[model samples]
Target: MRNLRYVLLAGLLGTALSAQADPVSYKLDPGHTMVLFSWSHFGFSHPVADIGITDGTLVFDEKNPSKASVEVTMPLSNLDTHVPALDKHLKEPDFFNADKYPTITFKSTGVKPLGGKKYKVMGDLTVHGVTKPVVLDATLNNVGPHPMTGQQAIGFNATGMIKRSDFGLGAYVPKVSDEIQINITTEGSVPKAGQQ
Candidate 1:
């Protein structure tokens, strides 16, 4: 009876340790992260815009990928179209209305692993006071220690598309192109002990 109890305790302890080993928490490294969007400009060329991320977190579990999730918040005021006049126009009531909305956010609802390091992430994205479902096709770029910082890091590249009209940003419509293509490249690092 004593031997059986010892074996059972050892098995329970091992199971607990294994369960804790897979999921890793990482904080978005803002300086090394980028979110950019491009849209057709009346058949002339594709114009690009930059949206800066305020903060985010990603929880990834390699062993059990279904448990992974990500959440990000972006400041609307940080949007840059590179053209001053156009940038101002985007903030007006006709477009983003930065003063009213203030920020945009995304929170994952589900994750589907597409074989190897690729995943399809379905999430709720809020923009211009409107929330809609969005899907991102993401690829894991790298996951390891950073050479410079020596901290555990993970990198990913993702692409997603959103229709401006769906989010109530329908200004020029067909002329300016309602569909915007988003491209994101980000690096996140594991937080130190006791840190958020």
Candidate 2:
């Protein structure tokens, strides 16, 4: 009877520990993480540009996702619109002015769980030397062991919107569309033991 009581106590303690698991840190996989944006082109079409992520980190706690935080940095030179001419034009003083403001970044301020795997992440986004508050509607796609690397991994897809004028990137305004739709797909992994 004493042994049974001891077993019950142990089980309860284990359950509590599991319920309060510490947050895990993950390094963003640059090859799999990318930011895509699209905007209207003179009411003719919407052109999309792909921006590769340079580096980022994510802190996530599966049991308490609301405590999660993220920080990402991307270089303007990594922007690609498929057309070399257009890409070059975007980096000039007329658009992003990549020479002066070399990088864009986002840092989370708060996280709000919206039930299930959805969340609203509020953060400050810096672009072209301007900073503005933005909110991303994010969804957790999956969290498990990575098949190829055999490391623990997590993925998310998120979307948000911003105005070029807000970031001092408005060159054409209504002509080329001031509003841009931003889409992000990112994969993060826990480094293997003894690896940083």
For this target, which candidate reaches the highest lDDT against the unseen true structure?
Answer: 2
List the candidates' TM-scores in order: 0.94, 0.90
Q: What digit string (tens of lDDT, one per residue) describes model 2 on residues 86-153?
A: 99999999888899999999999999999999999999999989999999999999998999888899
By summed lDDT, which 10 consecutive residues of candidate 1 come out lowest?
A: 59-68
Misplaced by over 4 Å in model 2 are 1-21
Query: In candidate 2, how many Å is residue 116 off?
Result: 1.3
| Stretches of model 1 off by over 4 angstroms after superposition | 1-4
Candidate 1 residues 23-120, lDDT tens each? 99899987888899999999899999888698999999978887899999999788898998988988888898998988999999999999999999
User: Candidates' lDDT values, in order?
Assistant: 0.92, 0.93
Q: How many residue pairs clash in all the candidates, one count each?
A: 0, 0
Pick out the ten consecutive residues of candidate 2 with the lowest summed lDDT: 15-24
Alpha carbon deviation, residue 90, candidate 1 (Å): 1.0
lDDT, candidate 2, equals 0.93
Note the residue pairs that clash in candidate 1.
none
The superposed Cα distance between candidate 2 and the true structure at residue 135, in angstroms, equals: 0.5
- How much does candidate 2 score in TM-score? 0.90
For model 1 the TM-score comes to 0.94
